[model samples]
Structure formats: structure tokens, C-alpha cells
Target: MPLMNWDSSLDVGVDKMNDEHQQILSLMNHIYDAREAGRSGPDVIALVDRLGQVTIDHFRDEEAYMEQIGYAGIASHKLIHKDLLDKFTGYASDIKGSGGQVPEKFLTFLKLWLTAHIRGIDMKYSPKADLLKAG
Candidate 1:
């Protein structure tokens, strides 16, 4: 089974954002699969690297969308993103510095953060977008 399944509730009512979210979830599953399969160090490292890049791109797109939509909580939203990014960056550095065995804690953190952010922060931006889409 995949580490994280895409819950319908995570849908933010934006096509692009939803797609990005799915991609992230997919990458998370890839990480889990790699660990479970006892994949080589370079294999897991490549997956992690791709995940980081995808996350960066997604955040940029989401933040830009928030700005375009005039979301009032944009500042706080950006702050949340920044904090998560910093955490991931630290984990990535550690993985690279070490022999590429990702700490289980890092996977746990990603799972928790992604779910929480989607249900909380991402949902905050969803209502207005839904309203706009409906009207």
C-alpha cells in the first residue's frame, strides 16, 4: 500500500493546486516504496531530490495563486510554507551528509505536515476559490 492516499478532502478546488498536491502524495509513496524495497542509496536519494524540486515548484505556484486571488492570509501562508521548506531542507542536507538513509522521522514529518497543511492552510484558501468558481 502507498504511504499516503489522496483524500478527497485535500482537494483545494483549484485544478493546478490539486494536481500538484497529488504529485506530492505520489512522491511520498515513491519514498515509502523505495525504503520498503531496500532500494539502493542513489535510488532513494534521487527520489528525495525530485520530491524537493516538485515541492519547491508547487509552493511557488500556490503562493503566486494566493497573491492573484488576493487571499488575505497570504503572509501567514508564506510563513508556513517557509517553515516547512526549512525543515525539509535540513532533512535533505542531513541525508546528503550521511549515507542517504533517510530518517524515519523525516518521512513521518512529511506525512503529518502535508495532511495538516492541506486540511488547515490549504482549506483556508479554498473557500473563496470555490465561491469564485461557483459564481
Candidate 2:
């Protein structure tokens, strides 16, 4: 089973952003699977790097979309993204430095971050986008 499953409940009502979010969830699952399969070291490191890149790309796209739509909370939203990115980067670096044994703490952190961010932050934008789409 995948670590993180994407569903409509996670959608923000923006097609592009929703797609990016799904991709991120898929990447998270991949990482979890790798860990569970006892595949660490360079393989895990590579997966972490890919996750980092995808995260950065998704955040940039989301921020750009917010800007285009003149979302009032864009600044705060970007800051949240930055904080999350920093956390993820730290995790990746720590794993790489440790020769690829990802700490249990890091896995827990990922799960918590994904759950909170998706349910709280991401969902907050959904209503507005849905209204726009309906119009």
C-alpha cells in the first residue's frame, strides 16, 4: 500500500495545483516504499533529491498561480512553503550525511507535515477556487 494516497478531498480546486499535489503525494509514497523495502543509501538519497526538486517546483507553481489570481494570503502561503521546504531539505541532508538510514523521526515528520498541510493549508484555498470555477 502507498504511504500517501491522493484523493479529491485533497484537491484545491485548481487543476494544475491539484495535479502537482498528487505528484507530491506519489513521491512521498515512493520514498516510504523505498524505506519499507530496506532500500536506503544512494537509492534513498536519489529519491529524496527528486522529492526536493518536485516540492520546489510545485511550490513555485502554486505561488505563481496565487499571484495570478491575486490571492491575498500569497505572502503567508509562500512563507509556509518555504518553511516546509527547509524542513524537507534538512531531512534530506541529514539522511545523506548519515549514509542513508533515514531516521524514524524524519518519517514521522513527513507524515505529520503532509497531513496538516493538506488538510489545513491546502483545503483553505479550495472554496475560493471552487467558487471561481462555478462562475
Candidate 3:
């Protein structure tokens, strides 16, 4: 099972946001491991649910930070967050309906989404914030 490693590059220069991101990554790894081990059921479903909740909470914190710092892309960032939440919610519902048997497709999707989203969208906001702090 491929694990999501927390790297400095994933940091958005916001301590709280970065910490939350780390937690999300950790939970993703846990879920991935459980899925790979064929341990599907309430255990996996509970992990997915927890990940979804953490994701929502992290997004909220990030949005609030964007507002505080007058981030120019706040609207687009929020849209991305909403889209992610929708996708996560759909995945959770599907797992619950399936009695917690998550398909391999879902695992692949989660890995790809987390990797790409953090590297792309999250990193985009980091430099500016870092610069602000440096100054």
C-alpha cells in the first residue's frame, strides 16, 4: 500500500492548516492500509467518515485563513474545497451502502486526489503566505 508522506512542500505556510493536512494524510494512509489488508466493514467505514470530517474541518480553517489574509483566490479555493467535500461524501455514502466494501477504484481516487490537490492547489497558496511572514 502506498502511503501519503507528509513533506515540507505540502505546507501552506499556515501552521494550523499544515498540521491538519498531516492528520489527513495520516488517516488516508491508515484507511489505505486497512483496505489493502482486506479489512473492509465498519472499521473502514469509520475511518472514511473520520477522514471526511477532518477534511471538512481543515477546509474551513483554510478558508478562514484566506479571508483573514485577503487571499485573491479565496473564491476558487472555496470552490475546490466544496468539490472535494462532495466527492468525499459520495465515496462515503457508496461505502456505507456497500456494507463498507470500498472498491479499489475509490482507493486509487483517494490517492490521486490527495497527491494532486495538495501539490497543486495547496502549494499555490504557500509561497505568498511564506513571503508575507518573511517580510
Best by lDDT: 1
lDDT of 3 by residue, 1-99 (tens): 456678776767778877888899888889888877888889999999999989988889888888887778889999998888898888899999988
Write down the lDDT of every candidate, Cα atoms only.
0.88, 0.82, 0.83
Off by over 4 Å in 2: 127-135
Candidate 1: regions farther than 4 A off: 128-135
lDDT of predicted model 2 = 0.82
Q: Write the per-residue lDDT of candidate 1 for residues 1-135, one digit (tens) a residue.
A: 888999777888889999999999999999888777766387788888999999999999999999998999999999999999999999888877776777789889989988999987898898555664577
lDDT of 2 by residue, 6-110 (tens): 776676778888788788788878888888888888988888899889989988888888788777888888899999998998999999998878787887887
In model 1, what are the clashing residue pairs, if there are any? none
TM-score of each: 0.91, 0.89, 0.88
Local error of candidate 2 at residue 28 (angstroms): 0.8
Q: Ten consecutive residues with minimal summed lDDT in candidate 2?
A: 124-133
User: How many clashes (backbone atoms < 3 Å, residues ≥3 apart in a chain or on different chains) does model 2 have?
Assistant: 0
Query: Residue 60 of candidate 3: its Cα lDDT?
Result: 90
Model 2 residue 14 lDDT score: 80
